[model samples]
Target: MSLIITDECINCDVCEPECPNGAIYQGDEIYEIDPNKCTECVGHFDEPQCQQVCPVDCIPLDPNNVETKEQLMEKFVKLTAKS
Candidate 1:
């Protein structure tokens, strides 16, 4: 599943740099996660680095866009141009 940053986010900017997919973004005074680019770090890392670094724990699973490992790998390849 992709991850979503809720309104509880303080915009601390801690999770942005930790994301390998670059899915996290500043939302005015909040932070948002792009589901299209969010792979839950399935292809690039063993765990979701953003969630690990998020101080507020705002990052949560995006139930609306659940994806399989193969799908996530395909997305990772497209987003990263994995050779």
Candidate 2:
């Protein structure tokens, strides 16, 4: 599943740099995760890097964009090829 940054985000700007996919961005109010670009760090790390660095623990799996590990890996491959 992709991750979502909730309103609990403190806007500390830590998670943005930690995201390997560059999915995290500063929204109008809080950091937002673009599901299209989020691969849960599948090709980069074992765990979501943003979640690990978010001080407020606002990052959580996005149920709306749920996907299996294989799907995430596929996404990672596709994204990497574009880079």
Alpha carbon lDDT of each predicted model:
0.87, 0.91
Model 2 residue pairs with clashes = none
lDDT for position 41 in model 2: 97
Over 1-83, each residue of candidate 2 has an lDDT whose tens digit, in order, gives 89899888889999999998889888999889999999999989989999898878999899899999999999999999955
lDDT of 1 by residue, 10-81 (tens): 878899988888898887768888999998898778989988998888888888888888888888889988
Error in Å for residue 52 of model 2: 0.7
Cα-lDDT of candidate 2: 0.91
Provide backbone clash counts, one per model. Answer: 0, 0
Clashing residue pairs in candidate 1, if any? none
Once superposed on the true structure, which residue ranges of model 1 sit more than 4 Å away at CA?
Answer: none
